[model samples]
Target: MKSHLIKDVGAKLMNRGHRAILAISGGRLLSAPFGMPTVELHTVGRKSGLPRSCYLTSPVHDGERIVLVASKGGDDRHPDWYRNLQATPDAEIVIEGVTRRVTARTATPAEKAELWPRIVASYRGYADYQKRTERDVPVVICENR
Candidate 1:
């Protein structure tokens, strides 16, 4: 199957919440080296009351929280999944072969100010992405449950 199709299947399986952890663990084993790999984030559709999944890079982590960026590669529009999270802060993240429930919130200005530099240091592409857009990209904190 194509990557997107595979991701969809994985997300659907995860939503069942049965053996999701096992699936995620397997994914981690398969995808690691190239910085934090992509994971399927299962979020609720703001209006549809159904699950939506998207592929996003896993950035740095602090304590129990994982950071994600809504960069969209500096595209003019924000990512759909980011918007969904804004509507409903509760979401599920599959990271490093583990699945966990998390509450998603945008970083506060102070938090962003502090965290953005760290992010750019770890992932240099972020700085280039910033230069491409007029609006500042948001850094989302996914606090684990």
Candidate 2:
């Protein structure tokens, strides 16, 4: 499938209302679609300078912090949101219907080493995603700003 198509479909399925169907509502979370926490990440468009948003799954989260994978479904290229965060790390995230400001940063090699196992444990697809591409899939850590 085309990259844009995958992103479009994913965005649609993960948005607020539809996400409720996947299991999160009014600060309460249940069993999510992939047994992960759902988050709406807001960022500035790197090229357009416009606000952009995408729904993502947090394979690791501790209420105050969130860890995201830039897997792009194992595509060779990084996802737009990942690039956006690289360009502008200041962002906002909404979890369980509550929004908060955050600073986004790519995990260091040591951090990745420690987090990788837990990440894959949360969702086995991450291991598959890493194996499917030659480039190292980055782990993004977002913490309250």
Candidate 3:
């Protein structure tokens, strides 16, 4: 599948449904599915300055640190949430019914080189997503404050 099609499915369907379920279940559902953790990331809009929330699966999680990929289903443009983190690295994430403050940063190329295989091992779709796009997908590390 192409990047745009995947993006559309996420932006238009799955994400919305997932967020609704998570909210309705009070952070109990839609988290750590099949042992892979998912967090609700809260970011400020880069342009609007409004708050935005995105649900993302973390391929790597240790203690209070999590790694997120700004793949947007391999879309050409980075997801708005990732751009928001770029403009404002300070953010919050909801994990397992708790909200924690965090700081975000893109991993360096060397870091990505070491991390990529581990990440793809955790979730194979990311590797497929990379194959679908020409841009280098960003790997963002969000650390607890």
Candidate 4:
């Protein structure tokens, strides 16, 4: 699968708010282009334990080692998912139709500086997103099992 195709299909799914499915499918499409599709992570709320899902892009294998940015479309407040991960680093991820347990953590300042450019280079919108917010965006790294 090609990245452009994944992006196209993903854009369609996202427009319809079918994010989970989109992520699942997109991850498969990313196999050849992006090396492998990232897993779609679903985490339970620390307080409520309710399920929450997000599409993640990884620079590693099957989201086994992944990084997420707290762009939140560059909003002032951090994304809710970021807070959720903070409350509980333990989470679930679905990759290529398989689900697995994983851990999540915020990257250190130095790590973020080193990784941010790579992220921006891969997804240019991130740089644009930064321009919209005043607070620094956080970079989250998810380690999968």
Q: After superposition, how far is residue 104 of candidate 2 from its true place, in Å?
A: 0.3
**Segments in model 1 whose C-alpha atoms lie over 4 Å from true places:** 1-30
- Report the poorest 10 consecutive residues by lDDT, candidate 1: 13-22
How displaced is residue 16 in candidate 4, in Å?
5.8
Candidate 3 lDDT over 1-145, as tens digits, reads 5856766766958889988887798767867764678888999999998988878888987886889999887777788888899999999987766788999999999989988998999988899889878999999999998
Tens digits of per-residue lDDT for model 4 on 1-145?
A: 4754665566546634546445578644443334435557787776798997766555434335677777766767786678898998898877667777779898899988888888877778788889988998888887865
Measured with C-alpha atoms, the lDDT of residue 142 in candidate 3 is 91
lDDT of 1 by residue, 8-102 (tens): 56655544553454367765443543376556689998889799886666667755988998887675557678889999999998876578899
User: Which pairs clash inside model 4?
Assistant: none
Which candidate order results from sorting by lDDT in descending order?
2, 3, 1, 4
> Which structure among the candidates has the greatest TM-score?
3
For model 4, what is the alpha-carbon lDDT of residue 143?
Answer: 82
Q: What is the C-alpha lDDT of each candidate?
A: 0.76, 0.86, 0.86, 0.70
TM-score per candidate, chains pooled: 0.75, 0.82, 0.87, 0.70
Q: TM-score for candidate 4, please give it.
A: 0.70
TM-score, prediction 2: 0.82
